[model samples]
Target: MDMERRTLLGLAAGAGMALSVTGARAQTIADGGRAGPADPTEIIRLWPDGTPGGEGVTVTPIVPERSTDPAFHDRYAQYTTDPILTVFRPERPNGSAMLLIPGGGYRWAVLDKEGYDVARVFAASGTTCFVLRYRLPADGWAAGADAPLQDAQRAIRLIRSRAADYGVDPKKIGVLGASAGGHLAGLASARTDAAYAATDAADALSLRPDLTVLMYPVATMADPYVHAGSRTHLLGETPSPERIAAYSLERMDWRGAAPVFLLHALDDASVPVENSLQLLTTLKAAAVPTEVHLFQEGSHGFGIRLIQGRPAQVWPDLVRAWAARLDFPL
Candidate 1:
C-alpha cells in the first residue's frame, strides 16, 4: 500500500477492536467476549436516576456506526440520550486526568477517531483519559443551548468526586475538546458558575478544569467567525443578543480562568481560524495563561491520525510537553 493508504489503514486498525461491537444501554465494552485493544476500562452512566432538564423529553437511544470502506474508516455515535464517561486508564498513570470531548458539530459524538483513538495516545503519556459522550442540544434537550455545557459540568464534578477510584489527583484534572465541543469547554472555563441546578453532592465539586485545550474550536457565536451549524444547533436561528454573548467564548468574562492551549489550522474550511485568534486575544487581555499553535496545514479535525506529512500529527506528544512546561504534573 502507498503511504496515504497505509496511514488510512493504520487509523482503521486502531479502532477496529472497539468499534465492531454494539450496545443498547450503557455497558462495558467487549467484542463478542474477546479482548479488544481500544475497549474502555469503564462505561459510567452520568445520570443513573434521571437527567436533569430531561423531563417530558423522550431521549433517543444511542446508535453507533462505522463505514465499511477501509479507505475511509469513520466511527461515530448519535442520539446520546444517556450521557456517559468512557474511561481509558493508563497502564502507568502519573495521577493526571484529561476529559476528552469529541465533536460532531453538536449533532453526534465521534467515538473512535476523536474518543478512543485519542484516549490511547494520552494514556501512553501516563495520563488517564475520560472520553465523554455528552448530550447534544439539538436532540430535543429541555436545557436547550445550555444542555451540552450542563453535561460537561456534571462530568467534571463526577470525575472529581471519585478521583481516587480513577487514580487521578483531584486537582490535576483538565479538559480537551474538538470543534463545537471546544466551544463548550471554552465557555465552561470562562466562569465557575453552575450550568444546572444542584441535584446531588457531586454538584458541589468545581466544574472548572485545571487546564483547557481546544482543537479547532468554534469559539464564537457571533457573525464573521461563527460555525453556522454549531450555532444553529446550539442557540437556534434567532438567538437573542444576550444568548449570543453568553456562548461566545472570546466575549465572555474570563478572569481567573484556567490556562488555555489552542490548536487551529489556517486552512481549515469548516471553522475559521479567527475563532481561536480572537479568543487568544481575549485570553491575553484577561491575563489568562494561554498558548496557541496555528499550522499552515492539517485542514480540520483528524484526532491524532498521523497524516503522512502534516505537522499537526505531533499534537499528541505536545500535550505532555505543554503540561511539563507549565509545571502541570502529567
Candidate 2:
C-alpha cells in the first residue's frame, strides 16, 4: 500500500485506542480534561412567550451515546425542549460572531464535537460564538420539517438583534454548521421569507447570515445525491416534490445567499463529497464568493479531532484566512 494510505490507517488505529480509553469517561472529560461550570455563560431562550407550534410538543432528553468501533463517543448534553442559544464570549473581541449549529441527522444535536468544541476554537480567534440547541424534527415536535428551520431562523435573528449587547457587529455575523446542521444553515441563508409567523420584534430582524461555514454538510434533499437518513428524518417517508425541491439548497435561489466556506472529505461516506461539490458549483455559477477544501482521507465527523493530521486539521486556519480576505469587521 502507498505510504499515505498506510499512515491514515495508523492514525485510525491510534484514534481507536484513544476512543477505548476515553469513551467510558466521556461525560467527565467532555471539557477537554478541564473542569468548569456545567452551566453555559448564558442561555437565552429563542422565544420569550411560547414557541410557535410547540404548544403540545413533547421532547425527550438528549442522552449521550457511545460508539462501538469506527464511530467514537460524541459527548452531547441533555436534549432541551425549549430552544436556546448558549453564549461563549471571546476574551478579545473582534466584533464578529458566528452561530454554531451541531448536526445529528435531524434526530438530535451533536453538542460537543460539533458545537462547543468548534465554539472554543472560534472564540479563541476573537469571535463571539453562540451554539444553538435547536429542536429536532424527528421527535415529532412541530409539523413536518418546519421545526428545525424555525428554530434556526429565530436563533440568527436573536443574535443579530442583540449584537450590541454581545459586543458583536450586526453586519459581521455568520452561521456555521455540520452535516444536517449545514443544511439548516444553507436554508437560513437562502430563504428570504420567515419559516414561522413573526410574533415578536426579534423576528423583524433579518435571518440571513453575512457568511456561512459548512463542514461535511448535507446540501440537498433531492434524489440520487441526497443523504437518505437526513432526508427521511427531515422530510417524512413520502414528501411532495415541491417540498423536496424547496429544501434542495443547491437548487434554491442564490440571489441573496451569503458567501460560503465548505470542507468535506473525499471519502465522506455519511454525507458524500458530492453534496459539497453541488453546492460549490451552484455558488460559483451565481457569482457567490466561495472556497472549498476536499481532503483525500478523514472519512466523516472528525470534528476538531486531529486524528487525520495536518491536511484535515487545517480547516480552521483556512477559515481564518478566508475571513481575513473578506475584511469582516473583526
21-54 per-residue lDDT for model 1 (tens digits)? 1223322222232333635435566777677776
What does candidate 2's lDDT look like per residue over 79-159, in tens digits?
446676777888998999999998888877887678877888898889999998887776656555878889889999989
> What is the TM-score of each predicted model, taking all chains together?
0.88, 0.84
**TM-score of predicted model 1?**
0.88
Model 2 — TM-score against the truth? 0.84
What residue runs in model 2 are displaced by over 4 Å at the alpha carbon?
A: 1-39, 65-73, 77-79, 306-308
Report the number of clashing residue pairs per model.
0, 1
Candidate 2: clashing residue pairs, number: 1
Q: Highest TM-score among the candidates is held by which one?
A: 1
Record all residue pairs in model 1 with backbone atoms less than 3 Å apart, i.e. clashing: none
RMSD of each: 7.1, 10.2
Model 2 has an lDDT value of 0.77
